[model samples]
Target: MVGFLGLFAHMAVIGVDTLFAVSSLVISNAITRQIKVGIPVWFCFAFGFAFTEWSNVRACWNDGKEGIIAGSAPVFPLLCIKLLLSWMTENKEAFATRTNAGDNTTITTSATSTSSTSQTGDARKAGGDINTNSKTGDTTKTGGEKKKRHLQLVKDNPDLEYVKEKAKEFYRKNGKWPGRPTLQRIAGCRENHARNALRELKGAS
Candidate 1:
């Protein structure tokens, strides 16, 4: 009966250590958005505890000393991992909030300017039917011409729109838009799309 109790204790220790390791990996990945960097560390610490516990189990099985592997050994590593994950989560939240706020301000200003320009244009065209294509020399201002122009713009400025959309999506997803530098790194824009957009908005105003 004593030997059976000892075996149960050994199994219990192993089970608890395994659970700790799995939980650490899950929490770290969720907070850090890093599966590659976090998973390996989790495995390393888990294996370390497992190694020590297995050694103790073997010793017990051979009629050697039991309870040599203290619960504290695995508990310490688990605590450290949890602390690191918490720090990462806090940082991510702060950064996301700040980025989102800035992006929202910029977007709001641009929208207001654009809306003013559109209002002015509507007032001016109350009597005169102003033809949009007259200024651009786009004689073929039909649906086909408009579609072609839209496609051409996308083809010419492939990365510009892509970067803008990505930044917008990032803000939507994380509640923080990416900085210009990060957008440049990811999207590789040569000219400033935000500045161009601002100019267009001002013209419309």
Candidate 2:
């Protein structure tokens, strides 16, 4: 619809030559952009095209007003306003999507941090094989320490499929790639396992 309007506006300005010569080029460019970039970019292009067409039409009409151009009909600026509104609506939708994704990420991060802190406290209370360095006096978790349920050595773990699904779900929600730690927390798997699964999932994608 936008393309048709743009072509019509351009036709009114540049005559039939643009309709024949430029239309094919425009269609090809639109297809390329739609395939490579996305639909949002096309909306941006539509807004720009509408603006350009409106400017040209108004300029021609101005020239006619000053007796500089002959047979230049006055055009209503409603089309440009409508196009501008459409662009604004598209921007708002994009902004809302980003905002939702950011919110999900923030909430997930906060919950993960809190869960980690609680698990660490529980480990300390239960004396889960923490080692204290003699020189630095820093307590470090030992190899036997298990804060979260994870199958590190099980290559054929059934949770691997579940983790992959959750990883994709997280990406869809967050509008970004999930990190190893985030995937581990989401899928309740070991960081290494989550990392490997995410790698495979990304490769397949």
Candidate 3:
């Protein structure tokens, strides 16, 4: 806990708007929304600055407080690296989710296109001119099929993936995954299913 708080204070002292500071804010917020719940970045920096300046007096330095004040410098680069690593891991998960969603959409669109093409051929055989009405109806039918497929995807969503995301969010806010009672509250899932989901998430597979 001390190291974490020190990291936040170190980030601010460097420069609140600097790249590392900004990245710290992003990484911190990804895990914690309420500054009160976590460390208040701006306030911590201000406090650290004030403390350092106050301790810089000749009397305080002679008392050996300067060594502690000077310790702040090294933490700056280390905290930046920590924040960047957290961001990279979170970004990877987010990107994977988007890729999965896009794949599902692509599959649905291709199905619609294939169904439309098949209907178009049938229309040409049955009439002097291809039946425009038939093509339109086929398009609508494929659209409904796509909707059903989308719903199915959600219903069949990998339980581990769903639970992992919720668990990560909960951990960010509270610094720990919920045990039995609170787990379902954060997950918004039924108790039995949540347990099953937990197994999948925790499983080797």
Off by over 4 Å in 2: 1-158
Clashes, model 3 = 1
List per-candidate RMSD values in Å: 36.7, 35.6, 42.1
Clashing pairs in 1: 117-204, 117-205
Residue-level lDDT tens digits of model 3 in 105-137? 999999999999999987777673457668888
Ranking by TM-score: 1, 2, 3
In angstroms, the error of model 3 at 102 is: 1.7
Stronger candidate by TM-score (1 vs 2):
1
Residue-level lDDT tens digits of model 1 in 122-198:
88796345554463455655666887765554433444456666666666788765666555544545347644533
lDDT of candidates 1 onward, in order: 0.61, 0.61, 0.60
Q: Tens digit of lDDT per residue, candidate 2, span 148-185?
A: 22444334445778888888898889987799888777
TM-score on alpha carbons, each prediction: 0.28, 0.25, 0.25
Native-to-model Cα distance after best TM-score fit, residue 89 in candidate 2, in Å:
99
Total colliding residue pairs, candidate 1: 2
